[model samples]
Target: MTIAYDWLALGAAACWAVTGLISAPQSRHLGAFAFTRWRMGLVFLALAPVAWLSGGLQQLSLVQLGILVLSGLVGIFIGDTALFASMNRLGPRRTGVLFATHAFFSAVLGFLFLDERMGAQALVGGVLIVAGVMTAIAWGARKDESHAFESLQGHWPTGVALGLLAALCQAGGSFIAKPVMAAGVDPMAAMVVRVGVTCLAHLLLLWSGVGLARAQGTMTPRVLGLVLLSGAIGMGLGMSLILLALRHGEVGMVGILSSVSPVLVLPLLWLTMGRAPARGAWWGAAMTVGGTVLVLLRSHS
Candidate 1:
């Protein structure tokens, strides 16, 4: 089950990577907060049947309901908002490198808060995965002329601060969900609760005039399709897979695998961008995959 869940986490990572690749341009046009709100709304609609088939809201206790809602707020709402803001400040490359810290945050917080511990080998594996991802992203990172990097000159500190906060929120949200998932909550059902709450929170923000009100204007057919695909793959499936992983695997290990999206993005880049990855990128991706395998093997043994 641990091995299976580890693979599932990896799959989730791949799905998220694809989501990032496909939806980035659309997200830029729509604004991150607006895009996310629309994407989650789509995800809510998509997951409804699955949630129903899985016995959905009926499966959760009052405590579980609260935890899942909190998890959604912290993870989807706060963390994602911070992440998009960080990307706006820092380029995607810097933000991507910073995002690698999430696994470390997960490991540390899991230890302190959940009493979850990784053995030395697992620790080494986790470190290697993070290092590899950072290397891969940073090595190939080019300046995006589109984002007006010069304008962000003095704002780097703000980006760094927001990036760290995003990482913390991500890790913290997972840790908060860990106990509930371990208590036998179905991952699919839990996802429904989490996404449902997140959708409502985003709606509340919209109602309060905090979120942008240009959903109809910004969503072209192409953009809407991309967003729907992203929501289906990333928010709908990827999130549920992570939850399933949390139920069956160690938090640190699952976090490590799930955060390997940058590594997974390499091949996609090659295929789409018409350039093979640099040797450093290849080496980094190899190291990340090797580390994931090592972690899974150690768990199995």
Candidate 2:
């Protein structure tokens, strides 16, 4: 069962990698706030009916519902908006590396708040995984690489700050949700609440006439399609998997497994951009795989 949860986390990582790839251009086009708003709206539309039919919403107590709402606001609303904002400035690869710090944040928070402790082997594996992700992204791009995805868009410091904030909020959100999930809240129902609250928040922000909340580029059919696709896969499916993993898995372990998104994104970038990653990327990927094996083996044992 632990191994199964590990796989679920890995699956979520894969989904998020794809989402990051699909989101880069659209995020730049729509602006981070607008893109997040639109994506959350779409995710809410898609998940609401399913959650209703499943009748999972009724299982939550008022306190649990409140906690879930807060998780949504922090995780989906703020964390996601910050993530894409960072991506717009730093590009997906660098942003991903910074975002990978969430694993450590989650581990620490789990220890402090949830009293979750990892074995020595698992801790070492987590360290290696994070090191590999940072290595792969920090040195991933070639010197002469001129692809838009490799180019920095705005102030690098601002991008870095946003990335770290996103990571922290992500960890915080998971910490908040862990208890509710462990109490046997349906994953889909929990997701609907989180996403629905986030969608409402975004709508409120947009309605407030904030210029930053407005779309930066004209919305086209192609962009809308990409938004819907990324939202469905990343927020809808990916997040649901995370919730499921949290149902039985420790937050630290789930976070460590899911933080492999940066490593996973490498191959997808290679496929989409038609260029092989650097030697450092391969080495880092190898380390990431070894670390993942260690973690999984620890779980099995």
Candidate 3:
């Protein structure tokens, strides 16, 4: 708890950034539904080992199990579903930027449930994040014609609606996770339950609605491998780290730090794709960093 929550949050953000960038290449070959399914499935497969290794499973209680599953359904299942949909609807750049909105939701959630006070730094940081998004995304563009970010504001209604949904689901998922674990659940065990439940949620969605199943791109062995990468990097390690950090720290800080994904992905996009982000991306980075720095300085007060 003594360490800055923002640090762990940043780690989560950076990890997620890498996860998205890594997943993007392979994701191109797969449809969003199929891609997300495999990605989440891999997470469930890996959770068994992680849970056992962490020794969190030994004492897994009913309440803990319940909370974990709920976390999965809400956080991984619903939150990520919305997230990936956003990626399809809006590309990674804009999605990442909009996804940063999770900070506001987390802040509100923290205030309500965790009784965590938002310092002046947190407030100012939140405003800066908004400013950054507005500055960067007001007219952001994506190279990928199919990606939603290309015309996000042009179809302002759809993009804003989906982003808000993703933000809410993620925020709710984060809010529910802490108290459950803090009530004495081990973080690793909690993750296993969440991932497993999330997997089921996807499965159920696929079955319940033909539209979801039909939405998928063809799933072949090659595509499956990429999904595995997504699970390993994006869900398994990244999510586990998030659970650990949230268990030990406040969600507000996590939210603030998590906002870094938009900024973190820029360099990677440039390096890997030989493409610089739209000018809006750079401005977003500055504001996100500035807001994050506000958290750092204020946490000292």
Leading candidate by lDDT? 2
- Residue 36, model 2: Cα distance from true site in angstroms: 0.4
- Write one digit per residue (lDDT tens) for candidate 2, span 1-301: 8989999999999999999999999999999999999999888898899888888988789999999999999998999999999999999999999899999999999898889888888888888898899889988888998999999988999999999999999999999999999999999999999999988988898899999999999999999999999999998889999999999999998999999999999999999889999989988888889889989989444
Backbone clash total, candidate 1: 0
Q: What would the per-residue lDDT of candidate 3 be over residues 1-301, giving only the tens digit for each residue?
A: 5355557667777778887766664554565566777776777677778678778787877777777788778887778877776666566776776787887888888988778876776679867866675565544445564432244423545755776788888878988888875566766678778777777766787888758544445677876776787677767667766777786677876776677777777777677656677777777768877876776666644
TM-score of 1: 0.89
Q: Rank the models by TM-score, top first.
A: 2, 1, 3
Off by over 4 Å in 2: 299-301
Worst lDDT 10-window in candidate 1 = 142-151
RMSD of each: 2.9, 1.0, 3.1
- Estimated TM-score for each candidate: 0.89, 0.98, 0.86
Candidate 1 ranges with C-alpha deviation above 4 Å: 88-92, 142-157, 211-217, 299-301
Q: What's the true lDDT of residue 62 in model 2?
A: 99
CA lDDT, candidate 2, residue 24: 96
* Candidate 3 least-lDDT 10 residues: 145-154
Return the lDDT, model 2, position 242: 98
> Candidate 1: global Cα-lDDT?
0.78
How many clashes (backbone N, Cα, C below 3 Å) per candidate?
0, 0, 4
